[model samples]
Target: MTTITAGRLREAAELLGIRNQATLNEIRARYSERVKEWHPDVSQNDPAESHEMTIRLKEAYDLLTDYCMNRPVSFRLEDLEKDLEQSPADYWMERFGDDPIWG
Candidate 1:
């Protein structure tokens, strides 16, 4: 039940050089490229800097993946308010459909 703000999502997207609309595949590809570029053993830069960059890239990738997986289809204020009015089960059912195992 952690709340994810739009600002956080935008920051993660920017760090990974991706648009807000990027798909999971796009995120994974970009993350792979960045990891290769910043991997301490591969980059031949100051190991500390390379390690830091790789850590940052992994963090951004995790954040974006979590956001994308849990995000609602849209974020209109009115829609959120309406969703809040529903019971948790109803809200999840509406958002994710009737996947029995997940719901």
Candidate 2:
């Protein structure tokens, strides 16, 4: 029973394109495909890039699978979408206050 944080879960989902209430099967399938695509044996034998991709792929898969198995079906996607929408505006404002982009 590994303890997982919301941020980690979100990061994994983003990495694996698991947005908008995607299913566990989708997560596993996508992650498996990505791993295959980025696997060291298949990535032109570039050890450095392969290692990095492998690490990222493993992290994303582990987090997503953990979340998928543990989280309830009642989990809501609307809250995450709203948060993403607001985060960008808040970030832009902080970077450049009263910008025309807000209009």
Candidate 3:
């Protein structure tokens, strides 16, 4: 229902130093670190920058948290089983090496 753009999402991710595919906990931890690093009460020497950064960081945190909270998730048994059961070679072989010529 939100009207967020891809650019805005990318900005939020970059602001919080989040890499691709972060879980909610990772996003929260990164936001906490960034806030602590820039909060005006803690970084008194640069209160102006700290204040500005704190505001930006909070917005980024809210955007990221909102996006994550609304994302759809799957919990099918086969999906979980696939994650736990795959080995590197088996994965490659099943997908690529199964071809008679390639194998």
- TM-score: which candidate is best? 3
lDDT of 2 by residue, 58-99 (tens): 888887777678666543698667656767667767767776
Candidate whose lDDT is highest: 3
lDDT of 1 at 87: 94
TM-score of 3: 0.71
List clash counts for every candidate, in order. 0, 0, 0
Question: Root-mean-square deviation of each candidate, in angstroms?
Answer: 11.3, 7.7, 7.0
lDDT of each: 0.84, 0.77, 0.87
Q: After superposition, how far is residue 62 of candidate 3 from its true place, in Å?
A: 0.4
Flag regions of model 1 displaced more than 4 Å: 1-3, 73-103
User: Mind giving the per-residue lDDT tens digits that candidate 1 earns over 17-95?
Assistant: 8864678999999999889999999998999999998998998899899987976786799988885788977765776
The residue pairs that clash in candidate 2, if any, are none
For TM-score, candidate 2 versus 3, the one ahead is 3
Count of clashing pairs, candidate 3: 0
Task: Please give the lDDT score at residue 22 for candidate 1.
Answer: 78
